[model samples]
Each structure stands twice: as structure tokens, then as C-alpha cells.
Target: MRRGARYRWVVLAVATFTQAASGFFVQGIGAMGIQLQRELGLSTAQLGLLVSAAQFVPLVGLLVAGELLDRCDERWVVGAGAGVVAVALGAGALVPGYAGLLAVLLVVGAGYSTVQPGGSKSVASWFHASQRGFAMGVRQAGLPLGAAFASAVLPLVAGAFGWRAALVTGGFVALLGAVAFMTLYRRPPGRAVLPRARTPRGVRMRLLREPAMVRTMLAGAGLISVQCGVGILTVLYLHEVAHAGAGAAALVLVATQGTGVLGRIALAAWSDRVGVGRQRAVVVCMVAVVAGMAVLLTPAGRSAAVACCAFLWLGFFGFGWYGPWVAQVTESAPPDRTGFALGLAMSVNQIAIVAVPPLLGLLKDLSGGFAPAWGLLIAMTLAALVASVRTGGARRSADPAPDRDEVACPS
Candidate 1:
């Protein structure tokens, strides 16, 4: 009977699957980017803008989706989101021009936003406080894991059947996963589940005034600056700078993503032991990111292997901060306000993602390479580190006892 209660594992698994599905669905764009540019006759700026369009829609979606997750059934809300993403991707595959592509990605991104907060809230509900970081790590790792899967497969699919065919294939896979999640995904059985609490209408204003939360959110956004810059440009950098073949560049993405999976899980789980708060851990991670960018600055030569190794290290730390940082955010949030806090944080993240890439890409365009652009990223990481230092020392809180009586074991 002790072992049988492990249905929580099933819940975690499906949630991971859904998050990973989103990754596979979006990562396809990056993998097929070069092909899409050629087929559509897009400039580098235009290509970056298309990728940004897919990323930008999630900001609005996240704001609204968080509210929905707080008030609605997870299964139904997520199921509907899944359907929207599937249809959006299917339409995206059929787009005849850049405008049509942007419109489709907007719809797809809205669908993408629903799964994240819903999955996160569900994980927080099912796990006890002590187990929260690992649970979140498992779920967060899905993003990179899914991206890795997509990066590996999508290029080949496009090579074989054209980019449109690859997009349609990805859409079909997402739709199938959505149907499965709707069918098999169950809330933990027999818990006396309470509706997620509501924040007052003025809570947004109140939260904006929160120095600690504000500092943390700003710090988090800064760290993600590196991720946004790297995600969009790393492939181009490899192709253009290192003169790597398409297969080789895709492998670099795989390496970057694969290490990030470990980094996300390992860093979060490490925070559980190291006795440092999430803020300091993030500062330390960003410092490593700065060093990774420095390594990239070195000339591409026999040392290129060293640069790849540096990227793996950088990738590990670059995207790894999210799990632990988000764990802290959720842990700090008032129970009723978890959804709002997370929503606002994601909104801030989306803004960084949307706002930063184009500026950095423009730097690349004007400078005729990425040296100046990467320098700007290093500056962003330094800014994040400063933000981390500005947040004062932590307050201690006792762990609450696990709610063993909350739910019966699933039979």
C-alpha cells in the first residue's frame, strides 16, 4: 500500500510529457529555421522576428492562463489548450506567407501558455513542501528534454519531406499527446481538494510593490537574457562562425539542451542541500554564463572543441536557473496568490524574451557578427548578478508537516 500511492509519479510523468510536447512543438521552428528562411526568402531579422513572434504570444497567454488555472479544472483547461495548439500548428504548416505564419504562431503560443501554469499548480498541489524542488525539477527538465528530441528529429524530417511536412508531423504528435493527457491525466485521487485561492483585484498593484518578489523577478529575467540570446543565435553562431555543417550545428543544440536538462534538475536538487537560497545560486550560475560567453569569444580553431565544451557548461548553467528560481518564487507566494505570482513572473520572462532577441539580433546585423552582441549578453548577466546582490539576506521559515491525511492512496 505504501508503494501503491505512487500515482503521484504518474501525474508528474504526464505533466512532464505535456511540457515536453510544447518544447517539441516549438523547438521545431529553430531546427528548421534555415530551411524556413530559404523557402520563405526571409532575412536574418525576419527569421528572428518569426521566432520572436512564436515566443511573444505566450506573454499574453500566460497572464490570462494563470487566472484560468486558478479557477478552472486542470484537465479541461489543458485539454482545450492542447486542441488550440494542435490546430494552430496544423495551420502554421499550411501558411503561404510570413504574415500567416506569425498569426498561426500566436494561436499556438496561447495554447502553449495554458499547460505551463496548470502543470505547475498541479505539481505544487500534489507534492509536499519538502519534495517540491525535485518535483518541479522533473517537470521543468521536460522543456530541454523535449527541445532535444525535436532538434534531433525535426531537421531530418524536414530534409526528407520538406519543412511544411515536418510542421504537420509535429502538430499531429502534439494532438495525439493532448488526447492522451486528457484521457489518462487524473488529479491525485481522493484528496479534499480546495479551489485555488483568489488574490484581490488590487494584488497586482500590491505585488508590483513587493521589493523581494520584484527583485527576484527582475533577477530571473536578467538570467534568462542569456538563454534568449543563446537559443535564437547559437545555431547561427555555430553555422556562421565555426563553419559547422547543419548536422553538426544541430548536434550542438542537442548538446546545449541535453546538458541543460541535467543542469536544471541538478541545480534545483543541489539547492535543497547547499543551504544557499535560490537568489545566490542564480548569481553563481550567471557568473558561469559570463565565463561561457567569454570562452565563445576565443577564435574558432582546434580550440573549437573547447568552445563546444564551454557551451555545454554554459548551457547547463544558463537555462538551469529556472527550476530553483521558480521553486523559491512558488514557495514564497501566499497560497492563494501562487498562480498570480507565477503568472507575473512568466509575463516578465516573456517580455525579456520578446524585447531582447531583436535588439541583440540587430547588434549582430550591424556589427556583421556576434562579438558585440555577445558582449551585450555578458553585460546582461552582470546586471542580473547585481540584481541578485541587491536583494537582502533571507528570512527563515519552518517547514510545515506533510498533510498525510489530505488524500488516501490510490488503489
Candidate 2:
């Protein structure tokens, strides 16, 4: 293989590993929910808040991380950010109460805000347009892969050593990821070597106004809501509604997340061959999510075997959609602004990620069942499907004019 080709794969491997490590603790939280409630005396909302607190800082931090990636080497930005995550989680192991855990997670979120955009930027820099979707899929798969690993392990750790030890173990894993990334990562050859400079506020605001950008943000709001709901509520729902044991319920979450890893890769590779490409792939995933949620509402879905299948389907489509969706966002940006575009788009997603979990938990608390929560996801995903079709068609016609300022980068 050519040296450039070989190096890009190396970059992909590093990006995937670091992303997995960074997300380890947060992803495991759902599996530990029952344990946390038992030990910490957490109400449903409080448990949901623990998830939301990690996401809250990303609303702004992603924008900053995006801007930094546009200016600096991803090696420093991504590596240092993962280091911060490790440090914060390590600190969290010693904190005394729910409030203290929330404070530590806020810091972890601040650090993590850098990892997603930074890893995407790094991988996007290395791959060409033709293969970018697949590459992005593999990179984004890290989250679910990390969550799967966490789901399998963290609950067991909490069971034996307590939840604090699980947090500490996650910290060590993140620390190793940081060291590996910093040691091995390099910038793609022939990319611009400009002095670090901020993206102008005017330029940032203008990118937000682009049709593709607006559509992506809106779609992300709904899709991410579904994803967050599945992440935070799936185990709880299975335990409470399906009468599954905590271990079985946690394993269901693991199955869902594990399937998501394959879903991202498969869907993204499919995008590379499709007619309308990534946007259409996202729409298809949305439709699948709606169908999956609808299945959850049916009587057949109450059967443990069927309910597991339903959630596995939701995991595949709901979480899998991000690969193509993110590919579309990166492709939509002007070459120089991919990082900013991703950051801006994901920052919008942060709103949904932070709000959905607690809100869904509230719905469950009020209704005394999972039906309302599943219905809400179904409705949200259906709306996103409609928006994607309309905006995607419109974007093709409007694409030539709105992005006149964008200069295509050499591949």
C-alpha cells in the first residue's frame, strides 16, 4: 500500500480508539442506573440529570473545539481533551454525593466536547470524498463500541467493587487512549499550513444560515433525541416494563449498542453506493427508527424476545444514522470549514441530547409506563424524515449559490 493510504487507516484506528475511551464512563452510566439509584438514593430525574450534565457543556464546548480544530493540529486538541476526561473521571471517583458527581461530569463534558469534532476533523482530513462516508462511519462507531464494552464491564465492576471503582477504571482506560493518540497521530500531508486563526463570527453565523446546515441541525435534534432516549431509557424500560432482570436489561442495552456499531458501518458503506447518498441514507434510518418505535408500542413488543429484537432494531437504525448524517454535514461544509460545520451542527444536537433523557424519564414517571416515551420518539423521528426529504431535495437546487465563498480543498 502507498504510504499515504496506510497512514490514513492508522489515523482512523487512533481516532476510533480515543473516541471509545473518552466515552467509556458516560456510556456505562445507563447500565449503572439501578446501582446508582440504590447507592446514591437518586430519583429518576436525578439519574437522568447525571447523563444530561455530561452533555450540557458540549453545547458550547463543541463550537470551541471545532474552531480550534480549524486552526490547530488535532493531535493536541483531541489528546489533551481525552486527558481531561480521564482526570475528571478520576476526580469523580472521590466525590461525595450526587452534586459532586455532577460537577465532575461537567468537567468531563467540557473535555469531551473536543473529542467528537476533533476526531471527525482528523478523519475527514485524511479521507477523500468518495470514501469519507465509510471512514466517518467507522470512526463514529467508536461511541457504541465503547458503550458496548462499558455496558458489558461497568455493571459487573459496580456489582463487585462499587460504582466509584467503575469510574476510576474508566479513567485509566481514557488515560491510555490519550497517551496512544498523542504518541501516534499526525496531520494529513499537503493540507494547508496556516497560522492558527479564529473563524470569523460573521462567517460562523453565515454557515448556520445555509440550507443544508439548517436541515442537518433540525434532523440532528430529532434523531439525537431518539438516540439519547434509547441510551438512557432502554435498560430502564426493559426492566420496568418487560419484567427483565437488571442483568438481562443491561445486556439488552449492550446488544442494542453492539448492533449500532455494525449499523453505522453498514449504513455508511451503503451510502457510498446510493443515488441520493448520505442524506437519503439518513432518511431511511429515520423511517426505520419510526418503525422500530411503533413496534415497541405493539402487544407483540411486550414479549421479552420481541422487545429485545425491537430495541436491537432501534439501536441499529437510530444510532447508526449518525455515520451518514455526519458525512453529509462534513460534505456540506466548504473544505476549510468542515470542523466548524461539524462543531456547529453537533452543538445544535447537544440541546436535544441534554434535554431528551430527563424529559423522557419525566414522561415515564408521570405515565407509569414506557408507552408515552416510545410514542414521542416515533413522532419525532417521523418529523425528521419529512424534513430530510424536503431539505435534501431543495439543497441540490440551492447548493450552487449559497456557498460561493467556499473554496474546495485538494484531495
Candidate 3:
């Protein structure tokens, strides 16, 4: 399949669905946070740990899964990974205890490591440079949209039939994703199934040595940190610092999330239409996120309306940054090493995802104010922006034909 082929759209839709389904169970943990706390006699930190446990394994699992993708077909790699997610989460419903549930979510994270990079590689296979940004954007959007949907429904399922039922429901959704991807996804017509390109050590060194990859990882870490800050701190800042009502502060978080979804799609599409290439698009998002985070430090941020707008701005570029950044990673990947490159870059990002929120929270606790946390994020982002500028254009010749993988096939 090629971008012009109708089946490419099918690939995009199925890949997007798989991304959503893969995350549905994990996202549900947050949705039913209170219920999990009450039924399990858990502390708030333990409840937070469930979400972390579900994500923690991906820190290493993604690289392993990415290597497998290069050797095998995505239909099988992603399908099997999704299948693992389905089975683990389904089995989790019967665990009935906190420790067991934590272990199960760990397994879910292991399985889920495949969905992100695998899905990106699949889309990159079908869509050329001209359209890859838009396709990647749409595919990335599925994650938040799916989480939002789970936020709405899984809580109800947990409320009515108990949390076990919610786990089962999420497992079913993941199963559907596995089946859909395996049943519908196809390789771009002329693209060959590549062999193991190199050893894991070799791959790691090669990618790390690439200037573009380094820049991508740096920017990704910084931007995702801002994303984590936006999600974890927005409501708290509005409620405690701005003197806004709890419900109103929460509504602002909702707007931030909703705007994030739109931003993912819109920003990625902009990269597609612009002639400046994906790297510039990613830098633009970085600039915007930096601007948004900096505003939180000023007196103007104390106004409820202004704080709400700032978070929305942060949400748009912070959460929206992934699409173009991922595109840049895939595009800059070594020949036939897109999956590993994507995985490696994202695993680096996972470090930020795991660390930033807690670090920011710790900063807030120690300082007795949110300003320190906000300033920390601004510094992180600005540092990355500066590093990116300093390292710019060093890899352009090596990265000349990013669309070299674009293959034409008969419809």
C-alpha cells in the first residue's frame, strides 16, 4: 500500500485504533483512580503507582519490541503485543489484590511497548513525506482521544459492575485492536521485509551518534516533560494558586486535554503542508511550549482566565509535540532501522514521562508554591531549544531523502 492507495487509509485507521486500544486499559487506571483507592484500601501514592506500573516497563521493553519489528512484520509484532496486553489485562480482572494487579499492569506495559513505535513504523511505511506528518498526527491523536473516551466510560463500568468489569472491558477493546491490525494491515507493496540490521549495541551506538537523532531525543525529553507538567499541575495551580473553584480548575484541565487532541492533528498537518521539513515544525512546537511555560512565572498568570489560557497553550504544544517529533525520528532513522530508532528515541522520552511530574511535584512541595515547578519546566524546555539550535543543520546531507522509503504499488 502507498499513500495514494485506499488501503493506506485503512492502515492508518487500524493503526490508530490499535494505539488507542493498547492504551485503553492503562488509561482506565487513571479514570477509576478513586474506585481503585477505595476498594483496595490504597493510599493516593499507591493509586498513582498503578498508573506508573502500567507505564514503567516500557522504559526498556520498547527497544526490544522495536528490534523485533525490524525482523518481523508489523501485523504480527503489533498484533501479538496487543494480544499480550489483552491477555494480561483480562487476567488482571481476576487478581482481586493490589500487588497482583500491579504486576499485571507491569505485563501490560511490556506488551504496550510495541504499539507506539510499531504503529509509527507502519504509518511511515505507507505514507510518504508529503503526507506522513498528517498521518502520524492523526494516528498519535488516537492515544488522547482513546484515553478521553476511557475516562468517560470505564469509570462507569467500574462503578456499576466493579473495577474488575472495567479491566475486562479494556481487554476486549485491545483484543479488537489486535484482530483489526492483523486482519487489515499490509506492507507497502514493494517494501521488502528487512533482516536484522545490526546488534542491539550497534544500533544503539549508531543512533546515538546521529546528530538529528540526538537533537530529536533532547527536544522530545524536554517537550514531554512539559506535557507531564501540564497534565499533573494545571488543575492544582488553578485551584490553589489562582483561587479558582475546584470544578472550574478541573474544567480548564479538560479544555487543555481537548485542545491537545486538536493540536496533535493540526500541528502534524501543518508539517505536511509546510516546505520547511518536520524538524522545523518540531522546533516551532518547542518554542510555543517554552513560551507557554514561561508565562506561568509572571504575575499575569495569577488571573484565572489567563492561567487557563496558558495551560491550554501549554497543552497544545506540549501534548501536540509528539506527532512531528516522532515523524522526525522516523524520517531520520538509519536505513530500515525506523522501528528501533523510533523505539530508542521514545524510551528516552519515557525517562522524562516518569521523572518530570514527580520532580515538579517535589519542587512544589519543597518550595510551597507552583512557581518553582513552572520555572523548572521552562528551563528544561529552553535548554533543549538552545541545544537544538546549536546542533542544527549538522545532519542535513545524511538525511537528504527522508521519503526514500515511499514505495508505489498497484491498487
Candidate 4:
């Protein structure tokens, strides 16, 4: 019994660490962008395309990874995924030209997408329905935590040793994560431990057939837009508008990501207590993001300070929806289809990610500032609000989740 309890915590830790490590591959790119462009003599469009290549290819890989995750052993799925990501990070150290950078980042994106479904599936398998929100929240916190680590360290590292050294160092850390996951990660070892709805075949078809699932998937894309778009733009805004140092801009991402970690825990816990549906949490976050964008658009100095506060708030709420969203989908999915449902969510989300980056970049190119970028984001958020309301805005009030005691997973 003691050993079993120990392994449970181990599993949770592995999931969280795996998430953090995988995120670092591209999460540090925003910081790296300023340096890379100056060193490589690249244009905004070229830089945007390079980042977009890394950002977008994951969607294709995710479609496959998601399906494979549902059908395969969770251990092998996550382990292999992490291994590929580690390799991609190491390869990132060798990107000598834009083409090489683009190619390597594509691989990194593919590998990183593999981690999410595998991790989400593991959480769904290990925890009870009541405790899922908290479990998933803890797991999802990895995204921002890992990004924060990158934001905090990479700039200083690059400043001291050059970008190559920074990439190699972070690459080594990611590789170590792959090794750690392989060593420590495991799931309960029997068919009986599986969720009732999980099945290998025909699962994807079933998930898409649900109206609620379709709306949720679309809503998730909007949620991701808020996170990804803000993350991509924040550095440029800080640099160009506020004339802040790259190091400080990097640190702003760190602070924003740090606040996101808190937001993930708080909003996830709140969702369980308030019986608020994931859609509601997403809507509230969209509202916060719009406000953050407004503040970000204001002129420099004090406005930058105000925008910083808004960024922190946006990070908190904007990132908070992920845990509950995963829980809701996994728990409510038809028996024998959690893998498919989760995978579909991941894939659809990857598509959103692919679409957003370049679109924002293009808008910036056309408008000559981030005002157009923020305006576009506001439009996307508004669209998400409509989708959320149509799907289940009222569901939060309709379905009161079990109390906190009931929602806490057992160690």
C-alpha cells in the first residue's frame, strides 16, 4: 500500500515534469527571436515564418500522436515522445541557417505535441472522476512552469555564452527529462484500471459525433489562441513599445508564466467548487485577455507597467482553463473513448496553434504595429465567447460540481 501511494505521486510528478520539459523546446523562442534576427539578419516575416514553422508542424504530429496515445501503452507513448523532443532540442543547437532552424523546429513541435495526450490520458486513468480537476490542474501547470524556466534562464544564459550555449544547455535538460520519464513513469498495470469508455478503434468518430464535443473543441482553439497569441506578441510589444531590454522582456514572460501557474491551480480548483463548466472559465479568461490587450496597446512607461499587471492577470485566467477542460472532456467522454476524445482535443488545438501565429504576424506587417494584432485577438476571443455560450455557458450554473473534498485526489 505504501509503495502504491509512492508510485501515485511519482506518476503525477513525472507528468508535470514531462510537461515542463517539453514546453521549453519552443517556449524559449520568443526570447531567442530578438537575438536570432539580429545575428542572422532576418526579417520580421522570415522570423515569424521560422517561429511559425516550429509552431505549426506540431498540429500534424499531434493528429498522429493523439490517436496513437489512445491506442498504445501510455508509458511507451510518453517516453518516446519525450525522447524525440529531447533530440529536437539538442538539434536546435545546430540550426545554422533559417532553413535548418525551420526544419529542426518542425521536429521539435511534432515531438512536443506527443506529450500532451499521453500525459492527459495517464491522469484520466489514475485519478477518480471527482479528483480529476485537481489532478489535471497540477499536470497542466507544467506548460507555464516550463516556459517560465526558459524565459527566466535562456536570456541570461544566451547573454553570457551566446545562443548556441543556451540552446545546448536547455537541450541537455530536455534530454534529461526524457531519461527521467523513462525511469520513473508508470501506469496501473491492468485492463481493469482503464476508463470504461476507452477503446482503440472508432473512438475518434464517436467523439466528433457529439455536439458538445464539437463546440468544446472549437472553444479550446479560441482558448489556445489567447495563450499562444499573447505569448508570441508580448516580447515584441515590450521591446518596441516600451523600449525595454531583452532581458527584462524575457523576465516579463517569466512573470507572466509564473502567474499562469497560479492561475492554473486557482481557476481549476474554483471550477470544481463553483460547478462552473470549462466553457465559462474560458469565457472569463477571454475577457481578461481582451483587457490585457487593451492595456498592452497603451503607450509606454506607466502604460507598460499597467500592461504588465494585465499580462499577469491574463496569464492567470487565460491559462487556468486547460486543467478543467481536460478533466471535463475525459470524464464526460463516452466510455472506451477517453483517449480519442483527448487526442481529438489535442489535434484540434494544434490546428488552432498552426493558424494563429502567422496570422498575427501578417496583421502586424500590414498594420505596422501590434494594434492590429490585438484587434484580431479580440475578434477571436469574441468568437470564442459565442461558441462557449452556445455550447454551455449556462451549464456552469446548471451543474454544480462536487465539493473540494470530493474533488481532491488521494495520494
Candidate that would win on lDDT: 2
Q: For model 4, how does the per-residue alpha-carbon lDDT over 303-401 read when each residue is reduced to its tens digit? A: 667767777877887777787777767755654456666767777887777777777878887788888877777788788778767766322222223
Residue by residue across 217-255, what tens digits does model 3's lDDT show? 999989888876776566568867899864466556666
Residue 325 miss distance in model 3 (angstroms): 0.7
Kindly report which residue stretches of model 4 are placed more than 4 angstroms away from their true locations once superposed.
189-203, 298-302, 393-411
Best by TM-score: 2
Overall local distance difference test of candidate 3: 0.80
Q: How high is the CA lDDT of each candidate model?
A: 0.74, 0.86, 0.80, 0.72
List the candidates' TM-scores in order. 0.92, 0.95, 0.88, 0.89
Off by over 4 Å in 1: 1-4, 189-198, 300-302, 394-411
- Could you list the CA RMSD of all candidates, in the order they appear? 2.6, 2.8, 3.1, 3.7
Task: Give the per-residue lDDT digits (tens) of candidate 2, residues 1-411.
Answer: 267667888899999999999999999999899998899998777888899999999999999998888888889999999999999999888998888999999999999998999999888777776677899899999999999999989999998999899989999999988998999988765555566578888888888777787777788888999988898888888888789999999999999999999999999989988877577788888888888888889998888888999899989988899898888888788777778898999999998889888888888888888889889888887887787667775654122222221211232
Q: By how many angstroms RMSD does model 4 differ from the true structure?
A: 3.7
* Candidate 3 Cα misplacement greater than 4 A, ranges: 1-4, 28-48, 96-98, 158-163, 197-200, 235-252, 297-304, 364-369, 397-403, 406-411
Error of 1 at 108 (Å): 0.7
